[model samples]
Target: MKAAIVPALNSPWEIREVPTPEPSANQVLIKIGASGLCYTDVHITKGAIPTQFPRTLGHEPVGEIVEVGVGVTSRKVGDRVGVPWVQSGCRRCEWCLRGKKMFCQQQIGTGVQTQGSHAEYMLAYADSTMLLPDSISYEQAAPVFCAGYTVWSGLRFADPKPHEKVAILGIGGLGHLAVQYSKAAGFETIAITHSKNKEKLVRDLGADEVVADAEALQKMGGADVILVTGNSYKSASAALKGLRSDGRMVLMGISEEPLEVTGDIITNRSRIIGSMQNGDEYLYEALDYVAKGKVKVISETYSLNDISRVYDRVANGEVRFRAVITDM
Candidate 1:
């Protein structure tokens, strides 16, 4: 089997023939149909995520089950599934017992801790794999595993009521899908971005209005819930003023700088929170929305052979939104 391996930090991705892995107890083997390339892969390559060398750094994959382990009863061969960020969590952990699997300290990250789905075949725990709806194609289902799941889970956790304004920061990957989800969930959707070029695109994605910056968002009665999807700490911090009194702000992207918690943030009783990918339940919800046409995942498709080139595009922000490696 040919796979892209990161031999070292800050090194180029190498596609080499490696032995394909077989499914273990409670695991299933998947023939990958499409894999989503995320910016976090760049972080891993730069040694920011602290993964071991010679790793395959892709987690968002949609594929078909080629074989199922003897202990796996929930899934069978010939089933279509999606492998998400959280591969598996220790079932005995308190967080996992409470249904908050992402918070489990013993969680296993698909690409970060173990071999990931960047090749023709990858291993996924049967319990962690999401059964993809037939209506959702592999290309569309791929990004929902990570980018879509993150934003959708964040928005749900924010818990905005009907008619409450929800502002999605950034117009790329996650933000684009957040706009659609926010609208479908009955929130008065707003798109906040520094780029004026995305105004039209965001509006077309179901946003009720587009604001150039956080200040403009404040002028529109402020957002009841602000979902931060941009990677810039400065931009996210400045957007604090856009939150309405007692509103909540969810950070879904990683930022280098700390968010300034000024007196104003405290006086307004605004809440700042961070959310990661949830359990299989959230993944199913993300896919359900996509299957029903409530959300549209915009992505550029690349062949598995061009994994390195696609990584370069993602790192340089050249891809319009999410990039998926298909044709495996």
Candidate 2:
């Protein structure tokens, strides 16, 4: 199998032939159809986040199952599935028992902790693989494993109601999807971006308003819920100031720097907040939304051989939205 292998940090990936993995107990071997390139991959490549070297760096994967191991009964060999970042969890943990598998202490991420879906064949725990609807294409289904689902889960944290103002910070990968999910969920969606270039693009993706300037934040009377999707602590702190009293703010972007928030911002307003990834329940809801044509993934498709260049594009914020690496 040919794969783009990252042999070292901050180095270009090399396309090499590697042995295809076989399914282990309770796991399945998938012939990857498509894999989503996320900012996390860039972070891992740059050593901003630590991971094993010689890693195949793709987690948002859509693939066809070729074989299943012992004890796997939910899916069959021919099933088309989406593999999320969370590969598996210790089901005995309290968090996992409560269905908050993403919070499980022993959770293993597909790319970070194990062999990921960057090659022709990949292995995944059968329990964590999601069966995609026949209607969803592999390219479309790829980003849903991470970007789409992250926004969906973040919205759950915000708990927006109809007519409520929800602001999505940074109209890029996660923020673009956040805007769409906010609209589909019946909220008044606003997209905040520093780039004037994204104004029209953000509005086209269902944002009721696209704010290009920081002054626009004050005119909105503050948002009922703010989803921080930018990878900047300063931007996130500014967003906290733009939240409505008693409103919630969910952080979806992982930053290397510590997030700085003024104590007064939270203490005076009684704001509730947190970060989240898709868990078992949220995963099902996210897929259901996609299957029903509610949440849509705005993505650009690239060939698997172009994985290294795609990472550079994502790191430089050159991608229109999400980038999916298709196996061609």
Quality of model 1 by C-alpha lDDT: 0.89
Regions of candidate 2 where Cα sits further than 4 Å from its true position? none
Q: Assess every candidate by TM-score.
A: 0.97, 0.93
| RMSD (Å) per prediction | 1.1, 1.9
Report the poorest 10 consecutive residues by lDDT, candidate 2.
Answer: 264-273
For model 1, which pairs clash?
Answer: none
lDDT of 2 by residue, 26-56 (tens): 9999999998888888888899878879888
| Model 1 steric clash total | 0
lDDT of 1 at 6: 89
The TM-score obtained by model 2 is 0.93
